[model samples]
Target: MFTGIVQERGEVVALDLAPDGADARVTVRGPLVTQDVQHGESIAVSGVCLTVVASHEDTFTADVMAETLLRTSAKEWAPGRAVNLERSVTPTTRLGGHVVQGHVDGIGTIVARVPHDGYDEFSISVGKDLARYIASKGAVAVDGISLTVIDVNDSPTGAVFTLGIIPETRTATTLGGAAVGSSVNIEVDVMAKYVERLLSFRDVEKA
Candidate 1:
């Protein structure tokens, strides 16, 4: 589990085939961070939790799945592409962000970036199927950074939402550099999905 708070920005040093089709070795650019990570420890890379496979002074390796790649923007990453990194929280750690399972619901693209009076607002568009799950002022995680939806709408292009980002966020994470048409990993609020599922069960029982 994670809190969707980005701790550091890492770069993709390498990504290549592993022994199995389900796994690949991802060498991250943040070597100082992963220098001491224990083998098998879980780390959230771009909102996807992956277990450590190997480590060194400047790089650590994680095994990634094809499903994860297909569901997120991680696959588009190249050797120099930056990624948001977050270490899994322990029992004693503070929950700065909301509970995130590192499970991406789908991918979203930045449709527009607008500068408001003070804050910057972003328009992120996703698939039509995910429209039902998104709600105005709801919680969503993009690239492992937790943010609230300022607005939601269905446009001729697709399902889109507006997000308000502060100056601090603009400097701390990779989102600061995000632009229109850029793909990002998205995780919808897990609680909302569960509530919807329970409501379906109630309907079945009533019938």
Candidate 2:
């Protein structure tokens, strides 16, 4: 579990994919997150929960399975790419953001960006499967950074949701350099999914 608070903007040192591309090993240089990290510790790298297999100096390595590659922007990761890094929350950790499992629900594409007085609003398009869990003023984790949804618009193909990003968030995370059409890992609020699941059981009982 995580709080969706990015502690470091790490850089991808290397990525070695298997010949069959079924899985891959990625090494990231995160001085802060690696300071006390140990083997088997969970880290949210760009919103994907990865286990540390090896920790050396300021870098750590983790394995990415095919399922992660299919559902996240990890498939496009390469050397020098910046990634958001957040260690798992401890019992005493402050809930600065919300409950973020670091389990990316799906990939979203940045479709539009508009500048505001002191912030920027970004519109992202997501599949209906993922958008169904999104609502205005609700929370969503984008690349491991928790953000509030400003609005949501349903479309024929999917849905486009807007977010307000402050200067602080833009300068501290990978999203600072995200451009239109860029792919990002998105994790909708876990509570919404749980609520939907619970309601389904009620419907079954009513029938």
Candidate 3:
């Protein structure tokens, strides 16, 4: 589990895709986050929970299975691509952001980026099926950074939400350099999904 607090911005140093395209080996340079990391430790890389296969002084390697690539924007990963990195939280860790499971629900695209007063407001489009779970003012994890939804606009085709990005957030996470049409891994509030599941059970009982 994580709190959606980005620890560092890491760069992909190497990406080795399998010849059969079944999996990939990714090595990232994250000095801060890799300082105390150990083999097999879980780390959130761009919102995807990946297990460390090998740990080094300033870099770590993880394998990305086909399923993960299919569900995330990781398929676009290449050397030099920057990514948000977070070490899994300990029991004493502060919940600076929100509960994040490091599970990417789906990939969303940045539709627009508006800069204002040294800050940025981004509008991202989510799939119609996943949009219902996102609510205005609610929390959503974009590329492992927790952000509040400023507004939600729903349409038959899709759902778009606006998020306010302060200077700190822009500099600390991958979202700061995110460009229009860029894909990001999104994880909606897990509590909302749990509540929906429980409500479905209640409806079944009522019937």
Best TM-score goes to which candidate?
2
> Considering only N, C-alpha and C atoms within 3 Å, which residue pairs clash in candidate 2?
none
- Those runs of model 1 whose alpha carbons end farther than 4 Å from true positions after fitting are 18-23, 155-158
Q: Each model's TM-score, in the order given?
A: 0.92, 0.98, 0.97
TM-score of candidate 1 relative to the true fold: 0.92
lDDT for each of the candidates?
0.85, 0.95, 0.94
Per-residue lDDT of candidate 3, residues 45-89 (tens digit): 999999999988899999999999899988999999999999999
lDDT (10s digit) by residue, model 1, range 55-170: 88878888778888778776776798888888888999899889999998889889899987767999988887677778898889998999989989986656889999888888
Q: Please report, as a residue range, the 10-residue window in candidate 3 with the lowest summed lDDT.
A: 169-178
RMSD of 1: 2.0
Per-residue alpha-carbon lDDT of candidate 2 for residues 6-94, written as tens digits (9 for 90 to 100): 99999999989999998899999999999999999999999999999999999999999999988999999999999999999999999
